[model samples]
Target: MPEQDDAEREFDLKWADNAERKEPSARARMLAARWKENPPEPQPFRADPDPAGPRRSSWISTVIVLGSVAAIILLLGYANFRAPY
Candidate 1:
């Protein structure tokens, strides 16, 4: 057998990593070709975005993030006070 390089040997256990690249699906290829011929019109990220629209509440996300940060801070403070080594 031919000798393998360091990079090849590193990924020897990961068979998928050493495997051939995957080809796009038939449908994907068809769509890509179709778009290449006649592409769709590009629109802004928010074409008709409502100003202050009835959307999902952000308080839930804010509370989760803020609570996680507070917990981390409290844990760090407790650890520092109790056993700061």
Candidate 2:
């Protein structure tokens, strides 16, 4: 074999000799190629009005969860009051 330069000595070409090579999925490769050919436009940066605060779905979820807990607590309290110790 010919002498390899220092630049090419970083990697051993025979590393793939016994190793099982993993390849990306067809869809991933297609997307990568498409991205290289025609990259998508970047979205304009904008500050969120309330990033940490509750979003619509988050508020709904919070209401549902808290409501359920409250209902259960009320039901237990009512049952305890109506029944004898």
Candidate 3:
């Protein structure tokens, strides 16, 4: 029984060795060949600007305008509702 187990282990190792010796897939070989023939080219940095120029009114400007209008309307309402005391 021990000899049989030893033979089976040896057979499994042989099979593993054969599998490891197999060649890579066709796609892998092609990729390797391409890399060897012509390595990748280094790319340069690129910068692109927005097609449209700066906004007419920035967020801060819009916020300020909206706040000023709201305050003016509230002040007018308060003045009109005040009781004469």
TM-score per model over all chains: 0.35, 0.35, 0.31
Model 1 RMSD in angstroms: 11.9
Clashing pairs in 3: none
Cα lDDT tens digits for candidate 3, 1-85: 4456888899998888888467889999999999899987765566344457776758889899999999999999899889565
**Residue-wise lDDT of candidate 1 within 1-85, one digit each (tens)?**
9999988977885876667886889999999999999998998887875567577679988999999999999999998899946
**Candidates sorted by TM-score, descending order?**
2, 1, 3
lDDT of 2 by residue, 1-85 (tens): 9999865764565565546986889999999999999997775578555568545787888999999999999999999999987
Question: Where is model 2 more than 4 Å wrong at Cα?
Answer: 1-56
TM-score of 3: 0.31
Clashing pairs in 1: none
* Residue pairs with backbone overlap in model 2: none
lDDT of each prediction vs. the true structure? 0.88, 0.83, 0.83
Error of 3 at 22 (Å): 90
Model 1 spans with C-alpha error above 4 angstroms: 1-56
